[model samples]
Target: MTMFRTLYGMLALCTLLLAPRTLPAQAAESLRTAEGTQRALPRAPRLPRTAFLENRTLVAAQLSPAGDAVAYLREKKDSRGLWLLPAGGGNARMLVGSTQADQLMWSRDGRWLFLRASRVLSIVGVDGRTGVRVPLGGTERRRVMKLDTSQPAAVLLGERVRAGTGERWRIVRMDARGQRTLLREDAHWIHDVALDAQGRIVALARFEGDHDALYRVRPDGTLREVLRLRPMDRLDLLGMQADGSLLMAGNPGGNFRRVMRLDANDRLQTLHQDPRGEADLDEVVIDPRTQQPLAASYRSTVAATYGIGDAQAVVADIARKLPDRDIGLQAGSGPYARWLVSERAPTLRDPRWYLYDPRNGNLRRILDDPGITANAPKEATLAPKIAIDYTASDGMRVHGFLLLPPGVDPARAPLVAQVHGGPINHFRAGYDGIAQFLANRGYVVFQSNFRGSTGHGRSYTFASNGDYGNGRVQQDIVEGVRWLLAQGIGDADRVGIVGHSFGGYSTLLGLTFQPELFKVGVAGAPPADLGWSMRWLVEAGDQGDLPDRSLRHTLQALSLDATDRATYTRLHAQSPLVNAGKLQRPLVIIAGGADRTVAIREVIHYTATLKALGRPLTLLVEPGGAHSPVDPIPREAYIFAMETMLQRHLGSPAPEPPGQRLRAYLRENLRLAGPEFAEFSSHQRRNPLLTDNSDAQE
Candidate 1:
């Protein structure tokens, strides 16, 4: 009997030992089931349209020179004002109410806030009691070039005025007593000016026709040319270092712009350069007291900063803790350093700001955009952008960003080739509203940095300078799409193209010249006839307050050759309006009624020609919209129209229409003037862009 009892006890102990191991497996199975059920359930409702369109409530937050107070611009409804808050904890107070003041800078003594209001330089007391405007002498726009807070009483100003058939640039030093001293004047445009700690002009950038001349100011107040950039090259002077050496950014020998220091002896030393040749050194962080470079930021696939010293090393460590966000040094140094870190991702509707202090080793949330945080969908997933590269037809390497919808098979997804404006500009990895919105709705978004795009070296830029509508520039985009299709990342049957300004021109070209590649096109502020647009720019030069010489120069650099009639004829041939009959796909053209950059008349004429030809096109006009729509109502409406059109053409599941409030706002703000306005109604026929392709396989 004792042996049997002992055996029973041994068996029970073995069972107990095995129970924990089996229990975890069972729990894991149960958890998996729960997650599957959750996935089957409907997702959280999407945020309202207005939630994405509202302007930022807080912006341009800066710390006081003493680091005892913080000042920021606050916008509520239609009112924008400056507000101050004590760092030690106190009630925030409005310094100035109902003012359009911006570009806030603190005085050296921390007693005044210097700002620009209505194109005039002004200053107000920190207590919000006294206000004074620096008499700039004329209404001709004046820009604050450099403010020497160390001196506390003087500022460098760039004054623009009309010269004989061109614009003349002048640099002046203005004191607190309203006394102005002219420093230099030139017929060529002055791009920027830099001042030393002693309130002396140390460096200046002058645009002289084909190249930018960078000049150094000597101790005798004489200007000497230090460097001259080629026609397509870019150069920017940051500031004078503690040793009086000039810190500059440009690509002198390499393909990328790197931070370099130029000494008085004309010797150039490289301070920082990114390993990726595509990155451009953007901004240099300087120590206010020592006037030295602490860190510098460069933008490649995304913005990244590198520390030049131990003090900045701590800041870089803190930045690494917060992945996928851009960190900026707003003000202060050492233990009292304050940083403005932005959380910008495609999944986020708006950016969130944070303030960090190295002394306390604490990162505190300062501002959360109410529009995004309060209204974002609970189940929305953030999409990831992948950096990609492809070879063009001529074997030129091209780079681009690709965003695919989460939880969807990219092979079966419809693709939108979203081109950026500024055929001169290139797209960076960040929170692009349009790309995110489209990806959220199940469309893959691809942004290509074609040959003409910046950040790829001067040769690449010059390659696209004269090749606007046709040539290798357009072929680069075509090859990109074909490469994606060949990789099975895009559904060839359902593809669309969309762009703004110069991008709009590319969209028109794609639809007219390569109709088989796209099923739909959406263009905003596109210049249809290059020749007419150039002429209009010259004619409208006299109507505006600014000079037109820059516009003429731009025309000469891009699509014009004043000496060749054949070149003009080739440019005219590239106009989509001349080949409206080839537009077999559905197209939507958006125009800003008040757009001065690309006149509304050009859009009107192009759409009128398409309408006359009975092509499948829709035109939506924003009555008082500028080149870029800023008003939330009209902007949201424009997005909604694009969404609806894409859904119909791609055969994707349509989300809920714009809420009643949004629809009412759109009706009040946007004008539906196209012949097919009825097609945009609640009950309308499927457009020609929506073709039934049941034979397409995944």
Candidate 2:
């Protein structure tokens, strides 16, 4: 028997409390209508709602040229921090000493470590020496930019604004001594900067509009435009080559991007073509481990770079020497070393890393962080991922993951539609909390990479064009539910939906627009109204509160006349609030009090409407939660509320106390058992934050 069978009593109570009330009214009106309204039997593979979130962590330690040490990041408890270990091997030391610090960069000399925190830039020495803040002059304006440091003693590209005037950025000399000297200032904004071996700078400058021109500038102020991207042609720089050439990764004349080498004489050569049907290269890092380009990391970090040269064959040949693990390309430092062919080992779940050493066709586990299974719970296991495709309403193929629960009847699991954020960002095949938590409680979670999701081609992404907050995206989600039902994997009568941010918006729309498909919904930090969000963004200025400029431009391009209120009203009609009256399902609306992205006012208004309607709506507000729940108390409280809600609605087990259950789940599933588990459990016992804020939001 599965875990859920033991909790049927809890499921019965939820069904009795939240059942649709109009059933009796319709039953008396007409026999035919009543028959049509009868709930369908639960689908097979009704996965449990409990799953584990596999946090994305950085591994595969590599030392710099000087080999003082190699560093990697360990992501646990949702806290990401850097740790340094001797390159040859020894005890690991914490680098930043705090999870808050990110973006670690090692200078060529390996003597200095640079980091960008918010808008400020600082460097730390490797010797654990005291840190010093580089002098950034001026009290009003921020630095325009920073120099590309591949070259030695790189200059600082910065702009200092006058008290009451606009500023022009000038290139300034910056050395290890922290000295500065003005170089030049111009009207154009520098899009990219790369330093050549000789200390000359190659800059990608954009004039008015989309016109980008590449220029080589010497310290003496001599400048020359080596290549120009015409208004008609699309050309962009990836980085600078050691031989003074430019590495370009954009489509000048093709569907997919191919690595192009542009010489000083303006001639172009194709180095490598991107894999078919995959996202184009965003950036490439030369592998310092092998002196060859090892990996190409994409925006989503789902994809990686591979060597097309002899190394490809060599990696395959070397794979024979290693365990039967999945070998793939990984991204990081220098040339010839471009693709760090790696083997992902699942027995460790931590995925033991193996470096692709082409010279001897050998693969070796680089650095291993063995999964500590001692503390993990026995009941909670890592969710199983299966890749599948479903056809959308428009006949477009949609790809997604079906996260199944462990040891379940596959025939009668409840379903939770887990929508991912970005609406544009696709779901990667990894462990996540929101989905796994639902699975742990006996709900089959369907994570879709619907239309408008990235990692696919630009065309597929554009399908979401003008569809922002439109019915199209919602239909994709709705169709996903239908697809699961078609597969006989989820019970339609027990389906629920939940998401955060855009995912939250999808959740709202999913409930409001297709109420019959799901019995309950949870939307966290969702934008209730798109129009209000746009206005809020415009008012936010440069605080990153608004959508990307490209998105704003696309919205206008779709003929959304901003001058006309009717246009705004028509678009606003697509919001969940406008159709809230159509919703008959229960919903949990959660929000952070200080969310700068989506104002709390909008959520308050939506919940106010639901309250006025006397609907079965539960609202969870976090006093300290921003767009994402970070504070441990609020986050745990959120998990508890969600678990209890699912238990109440889907008829799963009565939720264990938030603190006890969460501690157990974390320990059992995350392998955080024994003393560490006791420590974490005691810590939670001591902190009343989660329960303390439960009534605060209400």
Candidate 3:
């Protein structure tokens, strides 16, 4: 899920519930005559830019184990603080005075709340009266792997240590008293450690060349190889079950992942699998006390859950009663459960925390997001995404989601091919703000899950391993657009391409290699040169601080390597920087000033090259932004710039005039390197903020 999707859910819930009522009944009746002939309604009004970009008032909320109190992180203006509220619903009092603390977790006994701030792990009392920070030695990074809430004080941690040659992983156990003990050490790269009910490390997973090896730890500390996955298979440990077996999700011989149990004898027993082959078991709900699987969820077109036993079935029944929402087991155990459910279809909005007490057959709403509800459009106005499949030019079946603007003529609607970031990541059915924002502005959006995308199976994911830019992956996207145009759903002359990260790379490829296809291109933090990115990864591995072996191996899997001359040449040939002269369409490139993944230098070089070629390009540099623009300022600015660019190139209807916040962001963030920036600024100046009586012109 995108960061915006998660943050939008955390906003004030009252805004959602108190949103203005739908069009009046008298207005609706007047639209239709006495003979019941319907009249076409005016297009929905455009919401303020702040409605889509601002941080939620409430950042995060979590219910305590015993359900007596709820701890939440609240954001106001520039600062965020932690607060605790009684479960009965009253004013919340400040707990953590500092705004730096986040990722709140409660101790099993509900005595302490664990939080991380400035790379330090600290705990605060439930009463918000006392607290202590765990003393971590040196600057080496350490991560808390597992908090055995059952043990209350014991926390399993992964610490990096210098070994004979490369860096190794050591498992350390710490108590609330700040006492630390070295539990286990491994020469291999340990990814995760699982503890049994007794708080003993029973299993540890190590990353090998292509697959992960699961090792079982005996009482005497001897290691035994229990389960090893195939090249493309993956196993995620859910923890040790009550019967001393390990519950895991993996695709051993099947196309999709299934929840299964690996017994002490190494025999695997399948617990649950999605009946629809397209859906993969994404998450498993387990009982924290018993370590037993209660329910599992799969995401095919949309998310669906399967209950393991009767107790979970009852909860699932209640979840079904509330249609088009993703139900989550938040806290509490057994019959009395607290669920965090969010609207999953039509438009992704309205997330509320609910408490279900089976003893009284009562399901009461605990907390609701007011901001999301208030900003959400009515069902009739919002666009609906339909799952689509089309055969690629290479005979490969590709999947995608097509969202058409509501009440618009499909044949003439301009289209935006919005590509997702991770070329490896697959698109799921949900509320995507970027797609919705474009659709709302009178554009059809098509998000393609091309080759190498996950969720289908091993074969589909591995198919695009070596076919990065010039291969089948780009063809899949092209075919999807062609499919849309063939179906009379998109205007070929007004089509635009936009994406971030690898998707950004794809955007560049679309304009450079397939120049005739896209009228304009918007790339965000894209790796202009693949060979440079691979070399950076190789250097990081040599530094021996972070685990770069897996990254290096993945690069090799994709036939990308800086050391190999032939492979390096192939990658360079496919890079956008190498083909800057081929780009004929108008382009806008956005880069993060502080991005570590794709260095700012690469973006600067790419922009410089585009300038040298005199290509129509605009550059926006987000100061202090990361790989993806997370802050509201940069995020909104990016959207505002893209919306303006699309209107210019795609002949789409103009969105509402930019507000003060958006206008300031554009002036501050837009880089004055190219001539295109002046044109963008001029366009913004011409369209002043709209008045209530002013008619919006395209």
The residue-by-residue lDDT of candidate 1 on 1-698, one tens digit each, is 00000100111100111112222454334323332433344432444445455346665666776666778787776888888877655667888886677668776667778777655677778866555686443655577776664476567777777876766778877765567888777776687777777667778887766566788877786788988765555666777776768877778655677878888687888878765555667667666555567776665445566777655665666666666555555546444656555555444555566666667766766655453256553325545555556666565667677776666666678999998886768887655777767776778888888887776666677767577765678777877787777655679998999989878888988999988888888888888866556566555723222331254555566655423466667767777867778887887877787888788767777776676677877777778778877777668767777776687788676756777776665544333333334434544334222233332111
TM-score of 1: 0.84
TM-score head-to-head 1 vs 2, winner: 1
TM-score of every model versus the real structure: 0.84, 0.74, 0.86
RMSD of each: 12.6, 11.1, 9.7
Model 3 global lDDT (CA atoms, 0 to 1): 0.68
Clashes of 2: 51
Residue pairs clashing in model 3 are 12-370, 13-368, 13-369, 13-370, 14-370, 15-370, 16-370, 16-373, 16-374
- What is the Cα-based lDDT of residue 70 in candidate 1? 79
Clashes of each: 0, 51, 9
Candidate 2 lDDT by residue in tens digits, 532-630: 665564455233312112334334544332334665676588887787687777777778878887877677777766655667666666665588876
Q: What lDDT, from 0 to 1, does candidate 1 have?
A: 0.66
Candidate number with greatest TM-score: 3
Q: After superposition, how far is residue 380 of candidate 2 from its true place, in Å?
A: 9.6
Against the true structure, whose lDDT is highest? 3
How accurate locally, in lDDT, is each candidate?
0.66, 0.55, 0.68
